[model samples]
Target: MAPTRTGSKRLLHDLNQSIVFNLIMEHQAISRIKLARKSGLPASTITKIVGNLLAAGLVLEVSADESSGGRRPVLLSINASAGYVVGVRLREATITLTICDLQCNSTYTRECSYQPGTAPQQVITIMATAIRDLVAEAGLTMQQIFGVGIGLSGLIDSARGLCRVSTILGWQNVELGPALERQLKIPVRVDNDVNTLSIAEHLFGQGREADNFLLVTIGRGIGMGIVLGGAIYRGSFGGAGEFGHMTVDVRPDAPLCNCGKRGCLEALASDYGIVRTALGTDPGHAIEDAIVNLIARAHAGESEIVAIFRQAGITMGIAIANLINIFEPSHILIAGEGLRAGDLFLEPMRQTIPRHTFDARDDIELLICPTSDDLWARGAASLILHEIFQSPIYEDEEALALDDLVSQASKAQKHHKK
Candidate 1:
């Protein structure tokens, strides 16, 4: 009974601490009075919890605000330099890794190219080494690092840190989280690259204030991330937003996709597909070269190149319109490396979406944006940060005792089963 009562009290305390810390981080420079109002916690509890965080160097107090007169209230904010996390993005041809501080500021970044048929073990080794070097360069020890968050191209089971399938990498059932953890001896989080990008955009980019939005990324492959009620919607099996593979043409004559399907949106409009059509070859030079050439030709007002872009844009718009009809997100953010040619894609997409969509003028808005490679890594880091902020942090022995009790109960259950 004593142990149970102690555990209950500890759980309650940890929950309150997490809530207070999250409220401060979300509303930077918030006053204690306002934090109490927002968190529905007593002012005394908020004061005590904040003091503990400040002592741990996890939060800082900036200058006070004098808007309400009297003594200016001190404003609390997260300490951006409290710790660091590493973000790694594993793409088909390149692996990008970034070291970011608590505020999601990149302190260092490294890029490495992988051979076309690189094995998963080889790739993981290189990734681990890159992460180690980045942390060493930052003069931080392993313990100072929070964890590593990886964004990989595939159907990622983010909850388990597993890659369900990646046609590009020829990978399936890859235990990415456990593998990284084993090599690095640190906590790890993994998610689909596009989903991670959506999280990044929602937190820091175009979707920041949007309660509901759709982020469509066009590049090596097309994918989307849906944010509903200000949160990412990962459906059952963590495959909700694979919009790229959604069927657009059911005709048997349609082009085959890398996924062994015909008439998929990715089969027609992905970077590889576009380049294959433009160059008139199945196996040709790098798609990047073709894109550069296309951009130059479009800039030179070459009608053929412009027409191809226009057609692709219209197809993309039609796909988006379909998404709108179903989900009806408030804002649709078009991003990815391919957005460099947004000027060529925008007009056709704008023209076609309206033709296909049935909506009032103010229902949804579309915005085209470009993102840097670092943004992908930052998105990965945001994944870890979300988990950390939501996790209960115990500041006293009572919480530790409660955790021990829970562990013991689990062990006893296992023993009984045997």
Candidate 2:
């Protein structure tokens, strides 16, 4: 059904406001004229939209900037403290939580060790308690938080808020979102750990400037996230970014992957794969110390170990090149725990990618993102913050009406106190 005339007008207003708000957020302190030009909105329209944002305390006017020609323009900036959000990275070994301001800055963080195969409900409880403790440490109440975002290793059904399969956590079809929300009494968004990192890279990291890019995380496992046409491209069932499962080598002797498949890219490229290769050479070595010792040996001029790392890199490069040939993204970000090996591991990829990629794009930019546990937590928080800023046009009327009620109640409470 077509929207009513009033509904259409409201939608247009919300869209224009979102555009102006996003422009200011991205450009930092931007002048109204610059916002107008960037957003392709008329000056009058920009002014009206900015006025609404300013009144809502979502925008702030910073010091005037030197004018290009006319009077000095007042630069607009996002009010980073207008609200806050929580991000949690649920891992097999631990649960990490971070509180971030509107600007995606981490204000407080907490982490706690957990058993590798902790039950889903217990994980939710731990997350809720950690969120509460983190908020208390930040000296903020629950009302200050917009929402909670969680990232875990798995095949996430994001729309359903379920972790359909998580080899790391031994979870299958866990209703993570509903369980967390039930305890916290707030909105919760759950997604794959790499997908959350991709969101962070898209909004705050190297991918911030590119509308089209690919994020490849090579660590204990291999995962890929594609941002096409300015949004994450989750396949028909939110399983699109499973690049680790992509078959890269069909040779009969290829290493075995955790997915019970042979010749998969992850079987050759992930940290586990690298460790598996090392086991073949350094027999009976301390399995737990395999990755650390393997990289050390390769760096110490061990030709055989270096060759194994090189083979992993070569296989990774082929898969990455194939993806580039198909997607032609503006940039490809390679990140994860495995990147700590530095150029020792990446030089081979750097050399092999160009040899395989098609013309022109062979020189595609590759950005290495050095990731840590904290960054993953921050990424989780960014996920929720991203949703909080979504244009109201996409929200159902009931949700909008509930938001209006909340705003009205807050205003009334303030008036009553006065």
How many steric overlaps does candidate 2 have?
0
lDDT (0-100) at residue 336 of candidate 1? 88
**Tens-digit lDDT track for model 2 on 164-219?**
99876888899999888888887788888888999888888899889999999988
Q: 1-418, model 1: which lDDT tens digit per residue?
A: 0122245666787677778877887888899999999989998999888876776667799988877667888899988766677988888778888888767888888888878668888888888888888888877666667778898777988877899999888899988888888999877889888888888777767888898999999987898998998778888888888998988889977877778888888777777667766777653337777787787888899898888888788888899888888888889999888787776877887878877777633468888777778889888987766555643542322122222322333443344346
- Per-candidate total of colliding backbone pairs: 0, 0
Deviation of model 2 at 338, angstroms: 0.7
The whole-model lDDT of each prediction reads 0.78, 0.80
Candidate 1 regions exceeding 4 Å error are 1-11, 67-69, 283-285, 391-418
Name the TM-score of candidate 1: 0.88
